[model samples]
Target: MDYIDRAEATRRILAAKERAGLSFEELAQVVGAHEVWVASALLGQNTMSSEQAAAAGKALALDEATVAALSRDAARGSLPAAVPTDPLIYRFHEIVQVYGTTLKAVIEEKFGSGIMSAIDFSMDIDRVDDPRGDRVKVTLNGKFLPYRTW
Candidate 1:
């Protein structure tokens, strides 16, 4: 059998999901993972566990090979350029460009000379209704790792 290409498989999976009108939240429920994580895995940024992959495959009506491919490590960081061209994604980049230093300084002052652990992070996105307009609330929770002096 030919080897499964994860990128291609992810593309196929996304197409099938679209055709089936399955939202990331729906698929995440099937796989028992957060919607953002499920979307990231589908977009080839993260690898899913075998059980999660199988659950996703069943929900998306994907083939066995594609399910197995989902369990493999993704190359990740598949951005076309250093600066993304997409408008929504670019706004995030702009936010970091403007507030990154301020955030770093604040974080350092609060947590000492160390960094937050992305590997041990959790994120939540929520929608809050308002009179003027709805608001998007994003929360990033990461482990505070202190620098060790040898």
Candidate 2:
């Protein structure tokens, strides 16, 4: 298995993280990035600089090769299948299926012929206690890029 498979390196890092008993927050502090970003990078959803990778490796006690793998540019959005089979991931797919058009329409109306950028985005997740149950509060902040005319 290779890093390109998106499992080998990640698995090693996860093992080290477990052994260290370090939370994502603590690891993020060492990596000098936001927790969500650090998590995403580790999950192969984003790329990390050499320094960031070295820091992460040092903090996680990963091998140099794994650290080098972490620094490589990833082929992003490589899913196992077209539609995910995982229940939680499937729910997100369902959300997009049900509301994707609605979201596009509303975003166009508000942002004006523009689209939100995942490249230049920030996300935050929080836990909110509710009378019914604990709620997951997620905030996605993205820069809006308007369509350009020739």
Candidate 3:
């Protein structure tokens, strides 16, 4: 509850899971946590809030006392020591951060009023086997709908 070293708390919480004989993936599945988060928490690379720690504790079948201890541990933490090395998918995000305004203006200019329907959207990924190396292909499909008239 007091000033907890974020890094230290992460270690203790993760140790709790490990002592339960659960692998990172297994513990994540049990606690409904993302495997990445579980891994980070254990490695003292990621911090959590009281709520998150409590939830994780409950998921790991930790006792009430342990849950309380973790809840206190959750706060007073920062991000993972190392940033994830993987590249972020930027195309989809462009719709939110970059082209969002421009696209809105363009759509308003072309159509009376409309939006792309996520409900009708679809995605497909192809895993191709190659003698040189594997290849991943991705495709997206979606329907566009105009806003209702007055």
lDDT of candidates 1 onward, in order: 0.89, 0.86, 0.60
- Rank by TM-score (best first): 1, 2, 3
- Encode model 3's per-residue lDDT on 20-136: one tens digit a residue: 777777766755666656565545444455676666776666555545444343342333445434455444454456777997788678775888765565556568999999977
**lDDT value, candidate 3, whole model:** 0.60
Per-residue C-alpha lDDT of model 2 across residues 19-124, encoded as one tens digit per residue? 9999889989999999999988887777889999999989988887788878777757746768899898898889989999999999999989988998889999
- Give the clashing pairs for model 3: 45-80
Model 2 CA lDDT for position 25: 90
Q: Which of candidates 1 and 2 reaches a greater TM-score?
A: 1
Leading candidate by lDDT:
1
Q: Please report how far candidate 1 places residue 4 from its true position, in Å.
A: 2.6
- Candidate 1, residue 114: how far the Cα is off, in Å: 1.2
- Output the lDDT of residue 19, model 2: 99
Tens-digit lDDT string for candidate 1 (1-150) = 345898888789989999899999999999999998888898888899999999998888988888888988877776776899899889888999999999899999999999998778788889999999999998989999999999
Model 1: what TM-score? 0.93
Tell me how candidate 1 scores on lDDT: 0.89
In the predicted model 1, the residue pairs found to clash are: none
After superposing candidate 3 on the true structure, give the runs of residues whose Cα lies further than 4 Å from its correct spot: 47-51, 59-150
Q: Summing lDDT over every window of 10 consecutive residues in candidate 3, give the lowest-scoring window.
A: 71-80
Return the lDDT, model 2, position 71. Answer: 79
Per-residue error (Å), model 2, residue 34: 0.3
